[model samples]
Target: MASRRKTAIRLPRKYAKDEVIEVKTRIIHPNHNGRMAYKDQGYIAEYYVWKIEIFYGDESIITVSASAALSQNPYFTFMLRATHSAPLRVVWVDTQGDQYTESVDVVV
Candidate 1:
């Protein structure tokens, strides 16, 4: 199994109903592009977060496809309409098939 990495998520704990809310997220990753050669080893394999998905309850709020072009520990921000209090789930999937998930409770 892959080791778990650090992740951060920021959002208002409470919001008005039907109001647009801002969400900020980030994950710690090496984001190797498989272009650099190691001292003893050959070129490092490409490994990065290929997809990121956010869900408000059961509905998908946002989905993104990332590549080596993104910087290390990529950051993302987006807006969503808060319709009710629920759990906001964030998932990041890497090229190695590892998945990281974090959840925050939102109140309205």
Candidate 2:
């Protein structure tokens, strides 16, 4: 299925190693849980973004799991330590087996 999604994020342009930095993100998705759908279709089949994994450069940062209760466009805010100057990668997975990724460059 096509991932109709949009993501917004904020990160520090520079930081020190091990320094905590705030990160904010929001993703746009139909998040159609497929549990409720057109009467003729007998529900959409519960398709929604369920998991998200974050990576700082090659290092795995954090992972998150979500459910259909999430709003259509999910919002997330967290703190991550900058171990080095690298690009932060955020990948999200949906029930439809769709993946969405966003990246931010940071200098540590």
Candidate 3:
């Protein structure tokens, strides 16, 4: 994967009881496909978020499959239907066992 220039996220400050919430997220990383080398070593260790799971109140809302061509620090924007107040949790797992997580509070 290409390197992501920026890795971050943004969400609405508030939402209605049954409003559709927009969630945006980006990550800064070099999704090395484990086929390249920097200087030393025959190869560079693999690092990438192979899967991302987004959830609301423990219920999964969206899941995306990523690839190296997806670019480094991939950014994604999506919407989720929220019926009440809950916490949104995001979890990312890379091939190297690196785990990243984020959460947001949704108010209805």
Candidate 4:
């Protein structure tokens, strides 16, 4: 089983219909690129969040593709239009086929 990591998100609890709001997210990850080598250990295997998707209810809001170039514990901020009161889901998929999901309720 993949190790569980921490995630943080910030958004308004409520908003007017069609209101544009800022959504911020951060994930705690090592994001190894399989290129680094230590004096004792061999090359680290590549393990990074390769894709991220956000959804409002069943509708997809955004999708992002990331690479190893991204910094450790990547942070992202984006704008989303509030259309209804529903659960917002965020999903991240890593290179190792590990997935992490989280959700928060938003009132529109």
Candidate 5:
């Protein structure tokens, strides 16, 4: 599959050291589950995001395993402690083995 998906990352502009901060992320995808009929084209194939990996700097913070049951254009929000300046990254992998990544700098 073609990798042309859009991603977004939102974070606070200012945060104190060791302060808990909110991180928001999103990805644009169809997330087809092979159940939708397209006129006379039969059912759409089962294609959706299966895994998501979150990283704070070089450390893996969270990993999520998903299925076709997930909705299209998934959005996720989580909290993290602002320890130091580092890059917060999120990676999404679909059933087609396509990867989409987005990152933002978190300054403590």
Candidate 6:
């Protein structure tokens, strides 16, 4: 069930030390469970991004447990203080054990 999904993160190219910044992330997915019916289909099988983990540099910043209640192509926005130059990574896992990851460098 592993496949590549379009994932993106938007942030500033450079930030000042201790400056609070906004991080926007998105993943292209259907996000449907077995309950939702589709055209000509009885019900869509269970498939969704079940978990999301965000990391700044070496520190774990956030972890989100998601469900099918989330809309398709889920978008997320959050704020964090830019403390140093490091990679900000987001990891997403789907119900079928599919994983998608995207990262951006936070330069301060």
Clash pairs for candidate 4:
none
lDDT of 2 by residue, 26-86 (tens): 7888788767758785877787889988888998878889878888888788998777778
Summarize candidate 5's per-residue lDDT along 5-73 as a digit string, tens digits.
498889988789999989998999889988999889899898998898999999999999987888998
Which residue pairs show backbone clashes in model 1? none
Candidate 6 lDDT over 1-108, as tens digits, reads 267559999996667999999899999988986797778868889899999899999888999998788889888999999988899999999999999999999888
Model 4 — which ten-residue stretch has the worst lDDT? 1-10
Candidate 4 C-alpha error for residue 100, in Å: 0.5
Q: lDDT tens digits, residues 1-108, model 4? A: 256548867897667889999998888888997789956779888999998899999998799998798888888889988878899888988998988887888786
Clashes of 1: 0
For TM-score, the strongest prediction is: 5
TM-score of candidate 6 relative to the true fold: 0.88
Clashes by residue pair, model 3: 2-72, 3-72, 4-72, 7-26, 7-27, 8-26, 27-73
Q: How high is each candidate's TM-score?
A: 0.87, 0.81, 0.78, 0.87, 0.89, 0.88
Ranking by lDDT: 5, 6, 1, 4, 2, 3
Which of the two, 1 or 2, has more TM-score? Answer: 1
User: Residue 92 in model 2: shift from native, Å?
Assistant: 0.8
CA lDDT, candidate 2, residue 8: 62
14 in model 5: Cα distance from truth in Å?
Answer: 1.9
> Which pairs clash (backbone N, Cα, C closer than 3 Å) in model 2?
33-46, 33-47, 34-44, 34-45, 34-46
- The residue-level lDDT of candidate 6 at 108 comes to 80
Error of 2 at 18 (Å): 3.6
TM-score leaderboard ranking: 5, 6, 1, 4, 2, 3
